[model samples]
Target chain A: DAGVTQSPTHLIKTRGQQVTLRCSPKSGHDTVSWYQQALGQGPQFIFQYYEEEERQRGNFPDRFSGHQFPNYSSELNVNALLLGDSALYLCASSRGRFYEQYFGPGTRLTVT
Target chain B: AQTVTQSQPEMSVQEAETVTLSCTYDTSESDYYLFWYKQPPSRQMILVIRQEAYKQQNATENRFSVNFQKAAKSFSLKISDSQLGDAAMYFCAYRRAEIQGAQKLVFGQGTRLTINP
Candidate 1:
């Protein structure tokens, strides 16, 4: 079966600009979660979406938002991006709230 | 809230040898999950192995296994007969059994593994 897939393997954005990253969850999965992995660091949870609504979020600010479609695809939108926003964006999918998540090849965002 | 820690920033092992990466987490929640993920140069996060907190037996997945110490809050990954393909950043992660928004994963700083041939 096709696993989690993400769009734009890499990206380049300037400060204050906005960017949107897309993800198609693994087949048969229903929930999507976003994470940010900075250089030399493990990923930090950004937020998670289920039933097309956000259910929980991490320490990220309002600038970081996400959406989950009925088909289980997801979009992570970061507004007013800063250089610190430069990191690898990862998308993970799970069948439900208490299942192991499958991850996609991250999109490397380079904020210039 | 939970926190994961990987004290080893980097490690090197010769091919065909065995390497153990250490991890320790702090959590009061008795029911949870522990995981080890491998991120190769391609940047794809691959689930290496998983262990349920309630399970007393240590988890083993082929060449990859975990030493899960529930009371000590320590979970370590062991890779046997390491190959060049095993060179990657290994991450130790923790997830609460409580289902909330897909269950957030708290990851450690990560341990970079280098396999020398």
Candidate 2:
């Protein structure tokens, strides 16, 4: 009955550094997607993972990548972080590619 | 490339009154899905309501309802008997209806709603 859960509620990283955020999808869900929400703006899609392979990706650069484990958990990694990378990263899970997606509380990444 | 727009940056309503947030999207595909998500101060994105493009009936959830105009490509959310708890940032999102692989959601800029008692 547990919903989507993300780790490290808040994080601080310096420029040119790397960071990884984790997410455990909701029970009975398989697909995981990541999104970035900048200040005063809505979330922008980062990418989606299904069957341990990346299925869809947004316009994000190569610096942003993700991984999905067999257990349906996911990790979002951002390399060479910049101040603009500071935002709330959200993790959403759904039963399949065409189902309703439920989101987690999100990890707040602060690039210093 | 689909884009969702929420022209209202902010809106306010008196407690127990009603308020509507506007949203419009541009998509080349005819079959798609639209959603309204509520993000509170806690930053959790909660699904408020959703509308399927093929369906003529607008989607409704409890006190929340949507007016979907397919031709106009407009989707607006109406919150009835608004309460303080309803004060939050509301986002409009769109997704394609492809049955094959996963699709990413395109979100609007978001409308911040403030409920005054």
The number of the candidate with the highest lDDT is 2
Task: Give per-residue CA lDDT, model 2, range A33-52, as digits (tens).
Answer: 99999999999999999999
Calculate DockQ per candidate and list them.
0.81, 0.89
- Residue-level error in angstroms, candidate 2, position A50: 0.3
Tens digits of per-residue lDDT, candidate 1, A67-107, equal 88878899999999999999999999998867889999999
User: Which stretches of candidate 2 lie above 4 Å from their native place?
Assistant: none
Evaluated at residue B116, the lDDT of candidate 2 is 99
Separate clash counts for every candidate: 0, 0
- The superposed Cα distance between candidate 1 and the true structure at residue B89, in angstroms, equals 0.4
| Every model: iRMSD | 1.4, 0.9
Clashing pairs in 1: none
What is the lDDT for A42 in model 1?
Answer: 94
Best by TM-score: 2
Worst 10 residues of 1 chain B by lDDT: B95-104
- Candidate 2 lDDT over B47-100, as tens digits, reads 999999999999999999999999999999999999999999999999999887
